[model samples]
Structures are given as C-alpha cells and as structure tokens.
Target chain A: MILERQLRDELKQYASSQQCPPDMHARLRQQMEQAMGKGAFRPARFRRGVMAAAISAALLLPAAAFAGNPMLADRIYGSFEQLKKKMTAVTMEQYAALAGKLSGAQAQLGEKEYARYEALLKQYVRAAYEYGNGKGYIDFDALPAEKRAEMKQLLRELQPYFDRLNGERSAKEVLSPEAFDRYIEAQMTYQTVLAQAGIEAGQRFTSQDIPAHLRDRFEKAEAVIREVSRATDPRR
Target chain B: MNEWEVQQLLKRLAAGDLAAFDRIYEMTFQDVYRTLSLLLVNRGDIEDVMNEVYVGMWLSLPRYDPGRPFRYWLHGLIVRKAQDWRRKAWRRLRLLKRANWAKGTDGWTDDSVLAAETRQEVLTLVRRLPYKLRVVIILRYYHDYTLEEMAELLQIPLGTVKSRHHHALKKLRRQLEERPQGKVASTDDLGTTTT
Candidate 1:
C-alpha cells in the first residue's frame, strides 16, 4: 500500500509540475497548417513508387486520352513533374494519412509479394516515363502493345489497392458530394477507354454490365457507391 | 474544456478553422506531453509524436465519434503514436548499426538536459523497463487506467493486459528491492541497461 501511494505521488507530482515547452504549440500549429495545405504524401522511404502511382491515378480514366504527346521519356518525366505540381494543391498529409491505411494491407503481404509490388511500381514509372515523352508531353496509348500489357498487368495488381483507396476524397475543394459522384460517373466511359489499352474491365466492366451469374459483384457496385458517400459526407 | 465545448471546437475544426485547431492543441498539450514523456525516452521523439497526434487529431476529427469520451479517443491516438515511435526506433537502430555509429552509441544522452529532465531514479527505472512492461506501468499507474480499459485501448486481449501488468509490477518491485534500502542509488546499482 505504501509503495502504491509513493508511486502515485511521484507520478502525479511529475505530471502536475511539468508543462510542455511553450514553443511546441506554435511550431506544431504551423506544421498542421502546412500539412493541411499539401497533398497526401507516402513515407519518404516509399516516395519512390508514389510518383508513378499518382501519375497512373490520373490514368484512372483512359490511356488513349493521354496517348501520343510524343511517347518520349523526357516528355513523360516533365508531364509527371507537372502532375506532381498540380497534386501539391491538395493536402498531402491527408493523402498520406489515407495511404497509410494501405500500409496495413502491405504489411500483411509476404516479403516476396511486397518485393514484387515494388518491382511493379518501378516498371510503371518506367513505362510512364518512356511512353510518350519524346520532347514535352505524355501519350499513354502511343506506347507499344507489350508496354500496354505491362500497364494492364500493373493495373490488375493495383486493382485491389485502387479498390481499397477508391474512397478518394477529390483534391478539388469545391466539389460537392453529388457533383463528386457525377465526376467519377463521367469517368466510367473513360474507364472503358483505358480498358481499351488492356483492362478487360475497361471494355464491359461497368456497374450496369455485371453478369447475372456473378452474384458477389453486386457488392462491388454497392461498395463503390457507399465509399463515395462516405468520402463526401464528413462523419464529424 | 467541457464535453460540450470540446464538441463545439471539434465541429469548428472539421469545418477548417485553424483557430479551433490551436484551441484544441492548447487544451490537450499537457496531458498529451506527460503521457508521451512516460512512454518515450527521447525528447525529440516526444515532440515528433506529439506533432503526429495533434496533426492526426486534426485530420481525424471527421471520424471522431462524439458519443464516446473524447479523452479516451485522444489517448488512443497518443498510445498509437508512441507505438509508431517504437517501430521507428527499431528502424533507426538498424540504420545506426549499418552506418557504424562511431562517435556516439545507443546509451548516448546529453547529461545536462536528459539528466535534468529525468533526475528521478524511479522514473529512470521505469523508462528502462522493456517496452511492453513499461507501457503497462505507465498506463496503469501514471494514467490510472483499469486493466480492462488498457485492453480495450490497446486492442489486446484482457488476459494479455493482465499478465503484462502483473509482470510489470513484479519487475518494478524487484528493481526496488535491489536498491540498498532508503539510500540513493549509485549509477552502477541501476546499471546501464534494462531487460
């Protein structure tokens, strides 16, 4: 009993006597504001694949639209640089917070699987850089068919990641939930267009196209709608 | 802040009010700092993790459920950030090993600063305890949380939390026993390492 009382007294006394250094509040407040202003960031260690992942994120629609800016690696790199610039307008920390969720899924994978994911990330960046960057633009469709295959395979692997992260809060601050739904809905046609590059989903995988036999797929349709709802509606 | 007031602040925070975020940080800093000080050894780490908790609090406000106690929710974030620090420390240790840390070592501390902050032998002993045991002690005695509550907050089995608490108390008791009764402990007595 004495021991307990003494321990409690020491701890309580310490807590009551100590105050956080005064600078921390102002410094942290600045950081929070800065975080709020930036786009989502992955851990610096994982920032390598992020450029490719985000570049392809705009590729969520159609490859054809992005095709033929001359398919030069330099141009692709420049365009990638531009996309990264535009992405900065949104809050990176929030984006990183969301990406952090993917780490849980990543952690669950075996070492070899994670290595493969890393490899695919590199491949996607290469293909994007080399696709259509002769001088100064991007053209995803202009890439050779085999390169397109790489993107498709990459897409197949990334589908689950995209599904997990499909609860995308648009970086655009002004987009309303209803308007947001319309935004993604407009991409359905573009999804098919990108599918033309190679995703079988691009061809006929629209929500309306679910076959009668695959009962589980109705869940996909349901989940997509719900995620969008959750994204736009702030639960706080 | 009162429950209603905190809720109002949270609402303003979620709506993008920077002043509300500052208000929330000021309201919670001391408790958060004290809790973190118990869990971490490095002051720099405490600052980093506190930044995370507050920044995370701002980012996470939308998901905060008003129905539940706000302090518990905040503590949950605090504990998780501490765990993140633990994970990062392992990574840092690995880097230190790879880089061949020559000038300084893991036991390195600036005595003028660190010793002043952790002058108490009891606190030093507690900090030196293994991470699992240390956390249980901090949560139990410092925070005055029930084992059941610790289980829920830590998302561990109740039995696991109970065992950890029991083992932590036993270890602390043993440490206390080792000191020559009622005399100040020489640095050699406590030793340089913890199990």
Candidate 2:
C-alpha cells in the first residue's frame, strides 16, 4: 500500500526538480575517485634499535679503510656514541624547555644557534605528536608577540630537523639509513614549499578565530591546564 | 520488488553509482517537495530549500544504514530542513510585523478556471484557522499523510492527531458553510472547546 498516498503524489511532483546537476555530480565523483586512488599516506621512516645502529654505522662509516684510519674509526665511533646518548635521554619536558629558550633568544642568536634551536623545536613537535597529539590548553596572549613571530620563523628553519627526525625514526624500524635520510630531505623540501605558501605553526590562532561551538571546549581545556599548573606551583 | 532488492539498490547508490542515486531521488522527490512547500509558501524559497534537502540527502547517503527504511530517513531530513526554514522565516516575519502595522495572511490563490475559485476560497478559510489546525489539514488533506503516520512523523500522540484533525476540519467546514456560495453545512462547528 502507498504511504501518505494523497500528499505523496503532490510532494513527489515538487521534489522531482531537486536532482543533482549532472556536471556537479561528475566533478564531485572525479575528485573523490582521485583522492581514493592516491591512497593512504605512508607512515614516516624512523631509525631505532640494534638494526638502526648498524644502518647508522653503514652510513657514517666508510667501507674502505686506510693504513692510518684507526683514528678515523675512533672519531666515527665517538660521534655515534654521542648520538645514542642524545636520542636516549630526550623527553617531552626537555623539548618544551628548549622551545622556551629558542623563543627567548631567537632575536639575538646567530644562524648556527638558530639551526640548533630549530632542531630543538623539531624535538618538541615530535614529542607533542607522540604525546596524544599535544592537544593541551594554549594561551595566545601569554605568548609574547616577539616569541610568536620567532616561532613562525622557526617553523621554516625546523623543517630539515623534522625531516631528519622522521627519517631516523622510520629508519630505526627497517634498518635503512640512506632511505631515512632521503625521506627526511624530501620532507624538509616539502615543508619549505609549504612555508612559501605562508602557512606557519600557531598562526592565526586566537580566541576570536575559534568557531563558537569549539570555544567552550578550548576554554575548558585552558581552565583545566591552569588549575594543574597552579597546583604544581604553590607560589602562583 | 522485494525489500532485499531495495537494500541492494541503496548499497549501490551509496557506492557512488549515479543511476541508483537518480532512481532513489525520483522515487522520493515529490513527497519531499510537498513537505517543504507546505512549510515555505514562496515557490522560489521552496526550490532553494528543495535543492538543499536533496544535496543533504546525497551527502548523507554514505552514512545510511541498510536496515532502516530509506524513505523514512529521507522524509526525516525533509522535515528537519523545513523546520529550520520555518524558524528563519518566523524570525524575519516577526521583524516585518514589528515594522508594519498591517497583519499577514496565509494560503495561495492562483486565478483560473473550473473549481479554482472554490478551492482557493476553501484554502483561504483553512489558512485563517489556528496554525496548529492549519498544519493538520495541510498534512492530512494536501499531503495525504494518514493520521497515524502524521502523528508519528510529527512526534505527537495519535489521539492529539485525531483531535487536531477533527478541530481543523470542523473550523474549515464552519468557514465554508458561512461563505457566499455555501451549500451543505457541517453540523460540527468549531464552537466547542478542546481540552
């Protein structure tokens, strides 16, 4: 039996004109298909474990040795030892502290320190991503304008560092140091292109920029973080 | 013909098959449009809202669960969009009423031949009644949704639907009987109070 039979015909006649335009459907379908064909993004390459160390050795140490190359071997081993020490002790808190330092001294620092500071910034980013997307409370006004600008500039400078870190992590999984380096280099260049497009870390982020529905969530997160921080620091 | 075939069609449509989408659209478009037209009086507004309704349907098709009745889900979307339109329209009308001293009227009248005059007179009489009654008459007679289905779709009690149906028809009949070309009179006038 027909449902709502009387109004049915009239309503049907009225709704018939609402068909999707043929051109629009074709365009939408084409775009979706292209996205599907592109497929999933491959996970980033990283270097770790014993296999990672072996690959690092393969990359840092030359295959052929000269008669007096014993000193060179020792130097290479020393660098590896230092690298292992650096990677093992790195923590999220350390990255945040480094970020604090980088932002404070950004204006007065030279290019070499800037590069090192940018590497520290990359470490913070990796830690943030690792720590459940680092979706904590952020105070835009609390961050000094100069610090904000420095962070924006630092995003571009930190691209190579991010690439190297991602590569090292990926390489650690499969013992491919050369592959890791290539991946890192590609990412740095890609990020450079993105920087040219003028997208920056923490840019255009303000209370006004947030959508109405999400503002409540942001406020709650901020309040929660503030409470935690206050509890930790009795002087505050 | 069977429910299984309908389910298959819906799945294919969800998979981006254009032909299935069109079939589903054709099958459901009329009722959807009528529902919208009732909520919005302007033909142009109906056309715009209708497009939004179908576009919404298309966007939501992927999320359609095969077990649910597609028509019910589609109609639910139409009702939601129509309500949204009404809310916006009510805001605009309230502003307009404040600006102008004159009162607003309802229903349509397209001057033509045959029973056009009679239908227009009756429709105008129906529109002059309380909005709740008017909605019942429009949904019941104009759209032909059953009292039970109307109650279900509108989320009102079946008894309330019956009462509204009686009240609306009673008022329409009273108005029609009092008109100049009055013929048969309805004994049940809207003089009595409803609980």
Candidate 3:
C-alpha cells in the first residue's frame, strides 16, 4: 500500500506539470475542415441524394477517367518543386540511405543533442507523415469506417495530393490519370515530410538541411510530376 | 463542463460540429497530454499521438455511453491508441536501418540504482522500466485505474495486471533503494526498457 501511494504521488506530480501544445485545437480544426470538405454536412436527405448521384455518375464514367482539377494539380506540383529544398524524406529507410549527406550536420552536434534531435526527428516524421498521409495511407477503399473517420480528425491539407496516390478519391483539387496523380502526390507527400522535419530539426537542421542524396529524390519525384504534367497537358 | 453538457457536445461533434470539438478539446487536451506523456516517454510522439487520440475520440464518439464518466472513456481510447502507436513504432524501427536514435535511450537496465532526489529524476527511473511493466505502473498510479479497470481497458486478464503491478514495484523498489553514504550511483544500467 505504501509503495502504491508513493507511485501514485509521483505520477500525480508528473501529471500536474503536463500541458498540450497551444495550437493543437486550431490545427485539428483545420484538418477536420479539409477532411469533411465544404457542404458535406448538409441535411441527411440531401446528402443521400447527392451521394446517389455521385455513385451513378461514377458508374457512368469510363474506368480510365480520373477526378481532380488540372489547375490544382499544377499548384500542388509547383508547391512540391518549391518544398523539395526545405525538408527530408517520408520514411526512416529513405533518410537512412541519405545518411552520408547529413554527416557534416551530425559532426556539429554534441552526442546528447544528436540523440535528442534524432529521436525528435523520428517522432516528427512518424506523426506528420501519418497525419498528412491520412486517407492516402489506406487508399480509401481499404480504410474501415472507424479508420476513415479517424483520418477525418487528422491533417489533410495535402488531401488532393494524397488522393492521387491512394486511388479513387473524390477531391476537386487533384490531378488526373491514375499514374500521373500518383506521381504528383508522392512528391507532395515527400515535401510535406521535409517540411515537418524542418520544424522538428529546429535551427541546425533547417540551416544545413539540404543533402545531395535527398535532392536526388526531389529531382526524381518532381521529374515524375513534371512528366505527368506534360502527359496531361491539354495543349499537347 | 458536466457529463451531461459534454454528452451534448459529443452529439454536436458527431453531427460534424467543429465548435463542439474545439470546446471538448479545451476541456480534455491536458488530460490527453498527461495520459499520453505517461504512456510514451518520447515527448515528440505525444503531440502526434494526441492527434490520433483526439481523432480516435471523434471517430469513437458515436459509441460513447453518456451514462459513464467521459474521462474513463477518453482514457480507454488513449490507451488503445498508444498500444497501436507502440506496434507502429516497432514497425518504424524496422525501416530505420541505423536506429542510432535507439542509442541514447538504451543503456543499462541491469541492477541500476534509481534513487532520485527530485520528482523528475525518480520519474525518469519509472520511464526506464520495460514498456509492459512501465505501462502498468502508469495506468495504475498516474491514470489511477483500478486493476480491474486496467484489465478491461487493456483487454488483458486481471491476474496479469496484478502480477505486472507487483513485478514493476519490485523492480522499482530494488532500484530506488539508495546506495550507502548517499553517494550517487552510475546510470550505466539505468536506461529505459529492460527485457
């Protein structure tokens, strides 16, 4: 009983000192907005009619047809090109491959700081990558209702970008041709990873963030995006 | 807000009310953070996990029983999410070929003194306990769940929770016993997580 009391008291102290990030609600609100989409929460009867119509339209359309706006795709691709320089890759495997490039940066850090920074980086990547890749993670079709609803609670600023890669998504803000959409979304997601990494890395990583190996991924992901753009070009 | 009011907010939330979400978040974000902080030692994972927990709450809101206290329901969801997060973390480790990040955290957990003069220091020792044992301690002490409650929330047998609680306290007691002369002991074996 005494041991239990001591443990409880210690835990209570830790709990008292804890606080959440200030901007957590605002960020959540923004993500929920994107996930639900505008006009999605209309009256149930209206929603039913619209959903039925969508289903009908989907059935009528050719299997080759893809959803999303070219203009939006352009903006997404443009953003990726710009974002390539600022951040890192999506998975640890991707980053590990680029370890050599970050050696100079690692050399500057004290052992403890590097440990803390690297630990934070992994968490940041996992969180932001999971958050941004919400719908994309499941490919929409595979996501259970509970799982899909969970994604609705996460960041979806890259909804359109994620949709293309994941397959059969309904976002007006997307690019077309399943293959091309996949490419654009992949690059956008990569940039988003780097962008989140910048936040986690703080001053040091942001200052010396760009490594040649990561840059190659940028070129490849962007090159794919650009190629898709040319293929989807209305003028061509 | 009272349970009734929170239930009403949850209703609105299910209807896609962002205002209700914002309000519920205001009331519960601290608890959410504390619950996660206890479960996950990494500060960074807490923020991201908070995102999952809140969203999980929203998704799970439909099934929430208004008769029960909201806090317990929320804690249940948080524990489940942390479990999911831990599983994913192991998977994430596989992808990270050179998991040097795993370095600073893993050191000595074999017969290390955990005499902590300060509260934070002592808690660090608690954090060092293996994940299974550490979680039982946190759930029982920090979250204040009854053994039966933890068993229910964790979907494990009650006896297992009992044994783990006993095992953890025994491990902790061995470490918390101060060395002679009040001299500080080396932390070589004090790293979090032991087999």
Query: Per TM-score, what order, best first?
Result: 3, 1, 2
Across residues B109-145, which tens digit of lDDT does each residue of candidate 1 receive?
3223453775555666676677787787777778888
Q: Against the true structure, what is every candidate's RMSD?
A: 16.7, 26.3, 17.9
Worst 10 residues of 2 chain A by lDDT: A44-53
lDDT of 3 at B9: 92
TM-score, per-candidate, Cα-based: 0.48, 0.37, 0.50
Chain B, model 1, TM-score against the native? 0.75
For model 2, the stretches where C-alpha displacement exceeds 4 angstroms are A1-236, B1-3, B59-68, B90-119, B126-135, B189-195
Model 1, span A1-236: residue lDDT tens: 44454556667666677668788887777766666666442111210111123433322211111122221222333343453443322222222322332243245455566556545555655654455232112233465768655665564454333333333233134356564444343222233223233322101133334344432433443344344434433321
The order of the candidates by lDDT, greatest first, is: 1, 3, 2
- In candidate 2 chain B, where is summed lDDT lowest over 10 consecutive residues? B93-102
lDDT of 2 by residue, A1-236 (tens): 11123233433443353443335334334433443344431111111111111111112111111122222222322332443343332232222222332233343356676557545544433332332112211122334677534533444344333223322222223324554343333332322222233222212133454456555654454343223223222122
Which candidate gets the maximum lDDT versus the true structure? Answer: 1
The two-chain DockQ for each candidate, comma-separated, is 0.13, 0.02, 0.17
What tens-digit string does per-residue lDDT give for candidate 2 at B1-195?
Answer: 356776777777556666675665566655665566554433334544665576566557667666665655666677666655543331111001011111111112112321363344454454345556756666666555677777766668988988987776666666666777775555544422321
Error of 1 at B68 (Å): 1.7
Per-residue accuracy of model 3 over B75-186 as CA lDDT, tens digit each: 7788788866654431121111111122221211211232243434446667768778888888877876788887777768988888887777777766666624422433
